[model samples]
Target: MNTTPFRAGHVAVIGRPNVGKSTLTNALVGAHVAIVSPRPQTTRHRLIGIASYSEGQIVMVDTPGLHRDFGSANATAMHKWMNKAARGALDGVDAALLVVRAGQWEEADEYAYQALQRESLPVMLVINQVDRIVDKDQLLPYVAEVTKDREFAAVALISALKRKGLKELTRDILKLLPEQEAIYPEDEITDKSQRFLAAEMVREQVMRQLGEELPYATTVEIESFEVDGTMLRIGAVIWVERNGQKAIVIGKGGERLRDIGTQARLQMERLFGTKVFLQTWVRVREGWSGDERALRAFGYHD
Candidate 1:
């Protein structure tokens, strides 16, 4: 008979842009609840990913990257919203994971650490992408330098993409959580709805397929998500800031848009475990990223 008590609680996964927070969350949860791309600020919302084990459940609050440019003159409404969403994830959480890239700690990393320090929760330093370091011996010195002045509840060197050092990380995180019943059912993977996930799946492909500047100017909205028998019919609008951007997304003879839809539909089918009929359209919404009303209309609100 098992005598150990089940532990479960929320843990805020906080870090700078593209530090593998979403990747870590998806890995721990054993599902693609959060989208990932090579671009910075790919995650623009507060998403919850639930990881269930026999002994505990980790309700991970996967947040947007904590960036410093939100207060800058060039910062748009979208930037401010993303910043707010990241900060908001710290509230009422049992612990926080300050994930940073291996062998490098920049100003943005320090900024993220300071933000976590403001919160009273136990902040664990997750040194992610450790597999990228060619010299493994230098890891200890790098970790020492980062942890020199800061107080961390625990430190973990992990390669989120490679799934290395995860069991120990999970044990450390579970130890920080209180002993209690699971917050979510064992089978549940995320707190987001199917409709929201559908929109994100499309946006993930947009970020993957488009160029640097165009992705930041784009946002996806699901115009329709309906279930017909065993298949899901999803229609998404890829909103760009200009007509020229729309032309770029559509490409010559609409190949780009079709590819986006095809990839996104396959992802949806894999995630939702059903056939998906996906339709995508590129529409222009000029300066929508800077417009607060437009941001709300496209579901960027808290």
Candidate 2:
């Protein structure tokens, strides 16, 4: 019999935006808990996803990608909050996963690298998106170059999209976890609530449909969520910063809005495993992103 003591630890996933942090978190936990988009700054919050194992559980935190600058005056607030949120999650975590795209590290990645260096904790250098590397020979030099600068307790070369080499990474993470009882239930995949996930699903569809400045300007708030035995009644407001953005979200004759709702509703059904009646509206919340008070009210940050 394996007599090893139970282990549990929190691991923060940090990197540049779109480095597959959310995708990797989903693969590690075996569920979709964080939102993923091709757009930079897509992740606006720090989400915790729990991965259960026979010997222990790894509590993984998916954080916003660190960026050098928030943005121009218009976008500064959102990305500023994102940087704070990502930094906040690093505190008190047992270990860290410093994710990087397969063969290159850009300027935005420098922000993440700096943040990780500040933390006196064990970190694993996770080279994600390895599947994109058609030439395997080139990967070795890049990995070797990165490892020389910092001390990473472990190294995981895995394709988070293809789910390759994930088992080996999980094994290393398990070994690093401190001996302690599990903090969450065995079957729980994430600490996020259904309402939050529902909101994210809606936001994701909006991002996909809008596909530009529209995605950054949009935020989904679940105004009401009522559940009965057979179905769910969900009401959400898609908040935008300007009147023009609102019209864009609403689309011609409300067709775009309708499309967003229909797609969100279908995804909700799959997530909740029940019939869903979802209502979405485009509301203009001017300067909400820049307004600290407004952001705090919307659960962004103080």
Candidate 3:
């Protein structure tokens, strides 16, 4: 018979842009609840990923990257909203994991550390992308330098992409949580709806396929999501800021749009565990990312 109590609580995965916060969240939850791309600021909302174990469960709050440029003159309404979403995730979280690249710590990293310190919560320094480092011997000294002036409850060197050192990280995180029943059911993986996930699936492909050609002003809106038998029929509108951008997304003879839909549909099928019939269309919404009203219409509200 098992005598240990089950522990569960929310842990905020906080970090700068493109530091593998979403990757870590997905790895821990054992599902792709949060979308991922190589682009910075890929995550714009606060998502809850539930990771369940026999002894405990972790309700991970995957938030947008905490960036400093939101207050700048060039910052858009979406930028401010992203920063707001990131900061808001800290509320009511039992602990935080400050994720950063293995061999790099910059001013942005220090800013994130300061924000977490202000909350007075137990913070664990997660050095991600350690698999990219060629010199493993320098890891110890790098960790020491980062932790010299800052107070961290624990430090973990992990490769969220390769799924290395996550077991120990989970164990340390569970220690910070209170002893209680699971916050969510074991089978549940995320707190988002199928419709929302569907939109994100399309956006992920857009970000991945377009790369630098795609502007940050781009977004996706689910026009329709209906279930027919065991299959899901999803329609998404890819919104760009200009007609030229729309042309770029559609590509010559609409081949790019077709590829995007095909890839996104395959992802939906894998995640939803059913056949997905997806339709995608590119439309222009002039400067929607900078317009507050447009942002709200596209589901960017706080």
Candidate 4:
């Protein structure tokens, strides 16, 4: 089975919360395959982003951040799922890209280092958010610290938001990839379906417009999706932890909620390439964060 063109396999991009893992995955794939926001754990599921070059294809797995200290059942499950996605889903990956924030290492870095050590996998150390640093020389010490581990194949600095050093990094990654056949069909963009992306897009909108407090306590689920010729009819529910937050999301006279709906509709229209009829409702799911059943209903595992 010469899967040469199928240069298709999983490559996991992992790091602590808000380290630009999602940003990098989106940048590499040249699309918004994974949702991005300032909030931690914005990415709760493992998303596959495909980046195809004339020579090969790289399917990158963007997992949720590893929250080492979360003790709640839901948080623990999330953390375990993240590690499982990396180890199990990306087991035979040609290589791993370990993303770290630039400037200095922290306790999280130590944990990441130890995790990489156990895998015995070749790692590419990426110092993300270099655009935040003014002096190029300042990044050298960080590079030096990472290269101290002989397990690293190469080190590169990048700003995922600005798309810097991505080309070179992709080239290096492709070089290390095995000569396998493409794992996906040529036009396939992600492992998730349009329904999932629609839910995520709405969630991203909620996070972006509703601000931090409400966003973290919120989850969106698409209850129904129907495509009829020239338009898409979507029924969605937005879950908030409390009654007051529900009022806030729905807004005064439903103004804010309407605005959110308008924004989401436009994006969905563009994504689906058709007219979108989006209807939203709010629900009060007390302590939804701790509710295993609620999480599962919203597509997170128990």
Deviation in Å, model 1, residue 268 alpha carbon: 0.2
Residue-pair clashes per prediction, in order, are 0, 0, 0, 8
Task: Tell me the deviation in Å of residue 155 in model 3.
Answer: 0.4
lDDT (tens digit, per residue) of candidate 2 on 1-302:
99988899999999988899999999999877887778777789999999999888999999988876764355567778998888989999999998999998887777787788898888888999898999999998998988786788999999988999999999999888899999899988888899999999989888888868585888889999998779999999999999999999998999999999998898878767799999998889898887787777777863
Model 1 residue runs over 4 Å out of place are: none
**lDDT score, candidate 2, position 249:** 90
Model 3, range 1-302, lDDT digits (tens) per residue?
99878899999999999999999999999999899999998998899999999989999999999988975678889999998999999999999999999999999999899889899699999999999999999999999999998899999999999999999999999999999999898899999999999999899999999968984868999999999999998889999999999999999999999999999999999999999999899999898988999989999886
Predicted candidate 1 versus true structure: per-residue lDDT over 188-293, tens digit per residue: 9998999999999999998998847576989999999899999998889999998899998998999989999999999999999999999999899899999999
Q: Which residue window of length 10 is worst by lDDT in model 3?
A: 67-76
Cα RMSD of all models vs. native, in order, equals 0.9, 1.8, 0.9, 3.0
Candidate 3 — which pairs collide? none
Off by over 4 Å in 4: 1-6, 71-89
Residue 75 displacement in candidate 2 (angstroms): 6.6
Model 4: lDDT of residue 135: 90
- Residue 139's lDDT within candidate 2 is 91
